[model samples]
Target: MSKYIPGNQKHLTLNDRIYIENELAKGTTFKDIAAFLCKDPTTISKEVRTHRLSDWYHKGTFYNAKNFCIHRYHCQKTNACGKILLCGIKCASCPTCNQTCKDFEKERCKRLDKAPYVCNGCTKKINHCTIAHKYYYNGRAADRKYRELLISSRSGINMTKHQLHQKDQIISPLIEQGQSPYQILTNHPELDMSVRSMYTYIDKGLLTARNIDLKRQAKFKPRKCHKTQITDRSVFTHRTYSDFCSLDLSSFVEMDTVHSSRESNKTLLTLFFTKEKLFLAFLLNRCTKGAVRLTFDRLEKRLGTYEFISVFENILTDRGSEFGDPVSLETGIQGIQRSSIYYCDPMRSGQKGAIEQAHTMLRMVLPKGTSFEFLTQWDVNLIVNHINSTPREILSGRTPYEVALETLGEDILKAFQLKPIEPDKVNLTPKLIRFNH
Candidate 1:
């Protein structure tokens, strides 16, 4: 039906399993060619039948040999079945047939990647992953720096919060040598650090508890008072006690004003005993001269004539408008013989230490900046009575009443005394009562 075609094995040689061409060129018939080449008769029959019209075999011989040589060469360069050889069959002389060929055999089932990661068991991670590397390095370094700063900054704190005595025990050595924070930080870089961190360390209980006596180092500056001058002569030093040495005892009574607050509705002007710890406080609607004279007159009338003269000699007051007018106050002390009042130096309050000390007593009952206007006279009376009955170290641990009785003898105590306070009525103080007088 159609032209017969030769197979690809047509290029095979005798050594390459006996090609049908060799048997056919030897004058063998198609049947004999197939038998000798161990191929089917149809294979040989196809090869000869395709060139049946070609009488001359010599013309095709050269091209046929050329093609056969090319085919053999190519076949020699490859493995069996025409696949490129990694190592040829004859390994001795062929350079391309060595073990170093491109297609050399390798172990195909082995692993080729890197090792597993440290976080192998992590639920959200994969083996040999590196996702946490950046975060680990960053967080680890930050935590280290934080700890170093937190611990090292504590060296800068200098103060302690302990008692004064314990503070002396712990800090005397440092204070005795006059150590400054700058010097300390220089010597020990950990100490005397940033001010914020030092305060933080103190708040966190990292510093010693002994209180430090950090002196208010003066900043070189001029005075900052608003009032340029006060022309009150009686508010200065010794003005109130100018004639104290010349006057007899109980003749001079120190007078001073006590305020709760500057804008308080009521005021306190208390009388003082310079010799003893006796005090009398009175409340006033206003700190005016009339209010003071009236309160003093009432006190004078309340005490008997003998006792009144014994306690009231002269009134020593400041330049306050309430007590500055000698004319108004002279009428108040009318029955006293030759009573001479004295004035304190202008703005010199310490000269009237007797009344200043009485102020301290009142501070116990009415603390600093307390509102006297809100308090009753009964409260002031209770404080006065407590101070009178309270035994004081300055009076040989005796109450003011006892001191007066001791000075005047038992006859004075028994005659006009209303009631002698029981020993259990008040607590005695071992320490000296701080009296400005």
Candidate 2:
């Protein structure tokens, strides 16, 4: 048989087994067979030993040996004799041994120690072999066994019932109290469970908390489809994302709005400075284009048009209805341009991702479904001040307030009623507002 060359180091295939059987039939040695298949000799030896099946039969039945031997009782007492005085030989190999002999035992072939362990390479006819033992390797049977083992190894969880219950007792209360798994794990270093496993436990009903209890685990509704055509494409002709990327301007602000439950009419208008990571929030009576425009007019009046132009030289925002009137937003009461406005691509809020990432901190305080009806502008200012004062690794461990203090003058900070919060006292939770009262 021709040698088979292997392409890469992989499991043996059906073709390799067929070639091994053919090589064994030709009286080929394991080392030579291994060389032909590009495998180690020991690998071939182990494969044959592992997958080979053993068969047994009595030789006396075919040989027509007499059953009435006087030594049968002595042979039956001990299948093999330890001394010559008791019995001359083992019963299975003795000529007088038959199926009727109580000491009957199948004999193992001595040839199994030589080259091949199976009958596939034996020169003697299988049916005529006097030795009662035989071994044969079947590729199909070995393949089935391999697949069964692979599946069984991966089908079950490794945790014990007691360990699972302990995890549930620790994690369940925190989840019930409106803490996320990430938050729970962060605060409790000894939990030692992964976030994915916690989620899986909740999903599988292994914990007291269900998926419905998670703030963000609720089923998402499909977004309502709208016409793709821009209502005023002319406004975005020069204000597209491509144009925004080409500009080398150092100062730019991203603007977004946060809304409460549908029953509440109050909302928050958030402004973020990309350079310093400074955040400013204003609570509005309602979310409307007129409200947004009015907020800008007030800021211009408070800081004067020149200072407003200096502070908000460029503004980037999403295509929300509140920001639909970009012309009004960019112009002051005197109809002069105090700042330039740019819109992110429709439905692509990540185009201005910095502001969106900042919202996560806001959500940590006032969770989703919270009504903002009881909140005031002072409360919003407190939240923004705390957020601004928190140190950021991206800013080289400097707080936004520290960076803004050096970059933007005290007048601008005071104009917006923003104050620096103590690093240790900074609080982002709704409790900050409650505790102040």
Candidate 3:
């Protein structure tokens, strides 16, 4: 705790990686880049040295591509090929000079030993420079490599199949009669695997023994869900739920996105006003950061800048990838300050109970296991209008539309295409929604 840290535990994003690549191309120092990124200089150096790609194309270097000796340019030696007669070619220009010469030594760039590890910003005809055993940092390629590593590291079994088969050969048959992994491991000292790993192997069907053979295991309840680290932690800087709590604002809206299916692309972006119990939703073609930002842009254009900010002073949401770019969402099109975006704690959906309740109401009209591919914005608006019209018990028998109208006025409700429906006309059933496609 006494040690001073340069940066938090936040992972470097693609943007940061791209910035590193750009700065490296500009011949920037590691210390300066690290300072700008708020990271330790070692981090920047390691990232470059690790992810930098190598290039060793044939004959790709300055003069004397074939002869790579350090003293080739100034050497006066000739007939190094051990020919009886002079080859007439200077030892420096000979293709086999480095191979045939006795005192030849491999030449390497010493500048790559310390900082600016790559040849990006060399300022010496970089594009046309002969590419030898040189290293370069590419933003997209580095990002791709990092993503592949991140995904592969978390998936698949740790043990090899041969070891797994061997372990299974020892542990399976004993359990065929009626022996738990723990009991079997207690008696067998030769087995190298752990009891928990054996249980997992059985659960994954990798072993002959099954979960049904175990005693008292069937009665155990499922374990509680674990929390995953939030994606793109940089976006949550100064925009955490703790920061939101510090404001103590009475009228904040919770935002979320609802997907249809793994195969379908259409989704719904929802916003729930906690004070009025008012719900608003927009149909999105894709559940992506760009799509969410575009939705906010369209809303601002429709409602105007000042009115949009007045309505959405603060937006509290989860750490989904769709909300990764809070900066774009918080900034208005006209370069003015509009709204503030905050993220809820990971795996804590209950933090935004108002939006969860709104989704529950939403599921009533569009239940699970149904396709939303045919849904249109108008169809979604109809569903939302009906949802807002229905009276909520929490609102003291007042509908969301009524509360919204009383507080935000009829003009504001009209801006969102919300209208009051008669008590008899309000339908919570799935039969109310009509698909366009």
Candidate 4:
């Protein structure tokens, strides 16, 4: 037997129960079992008594008082008890003495009270024992019961329906106003709720809002798988995503074009600097490769080849048709290599995730299917300035305009018509455009 260590506080595990069951079957004393398990004797006693399964059987079917009483069948006691035919004396050995007899009283055993409370380590044969009430300790059954209780205890909320309605009234208006749960909690500390709880309320319809009311709660359709067909193998042979990963560069520019509608030829050419999160938007006259090339040409002419090379050292973009003429994009008008271009995998726009995320801010102001035909370059520049000026938590609460001014210099910002708005005045809705017009 192992020695018991004092002050060891841990729950009894399945292994401990199994060991107790095996030791009990071997007729080991409770003290010995406790020492082997490094637990108190009372703990073992309580465990066996608390978790044991109890059952009752018919008295005549499995129990006989003659086998337990010394008088046996030769005894001549009769009509002393109306309930059962047995000796009137309270026999401690008789199985049904306390159960059937009206005048019977139970006597406690000192051995059962001292250490082992039950018949765990009794050396007598179980079948010959006359005790009608039976108790059994099963490790697997006890473990399953414990697990069920653990799950049931954590299944529901503790708040009342009125309290939930109060929370719903506070959270619904903010959610409808397009403020995220985190933003609401940040702006109003009085609402004592977690972001996850807010989502749960929306999902359960406990509030006036639904899941669709949240901007990001709308589910995205799964991307359909299609066979890979290489129309121009040379376009991707050298400018693959693998080549982009191998380059030892700290900064890379992501470019993508946002279209208004299938019928509209006007689009916005967007470029994002990954490290600083600075966004640049140019309104294109036509959604064609020539317009994209012209935009880059204008940028190079304004920033000059040396400054342009410094800024756009590596450009990573999608395989959109507007970006098809990468050879023209990488070379200047004088036919000099100004930058390197790489293309992401097919249907894998998330490779350049920075720009894709930046488009979300644009969508807040100019939603999908809204025409950009009436929008001019100046309007696009104003929207880009507001977006770039908005502070981001990812940038340690600093706006992209501040970081760009420190890294890309004010001269480049002036050349690209990028400017910062006041932090409090930065608006990312269509109201900014409509009010100004």
- TM-score for each of the candidates: 0.39, 0.48, 0.59, 0.48
Which model, 3 or 4, shows the larger TM-score?
Answer: 3
lDDT of 4 at 207: 81
- List residue ranges in candidate 3 displaced over 4 A: 1-10, 13-15, 31-38, 57-64, 81-89, 93-96, 99-102, 127-131, 151-162, 212-275, 280-356, 364-386, 389-398, 408-437
User: Which parts of model 2 have CA positions greater than 4 angstroms off?
Assistant: 1-230
Candidate 3 residues 199-238, lDDT tens each? 8878888888788878777788999644234467788889
Candidate 4: Cα lDDT at 90: 36
Candidate order by lDDT, decreasing, is 3, 2, 4, 1
lDDT of 2 by residue, 302-392 (tens): 9999989989999998877677667878888888899988889888889889999899888877788888999888888888888998999
Cα lDDT of candidate 2 equals: 0.78
Off by over 4 Å in 4: 1-230
lDDT by residue (tens digit), candidate 1, 359-425: 7766765666666666676555556666678777887887877776665455533433323456575
Model 4: which residue pairs collide? none
* Candidate 3 global TM-score: 0.59
lDDT of 1: 0.50
Number of backbone collisions per candidate: 24, 0, 0, 0
Which has the higher lDDT value, candidate number 3 or candidate number 4?
3
Using lDDT as the yardstick, the better of models 2 and 4 is 2
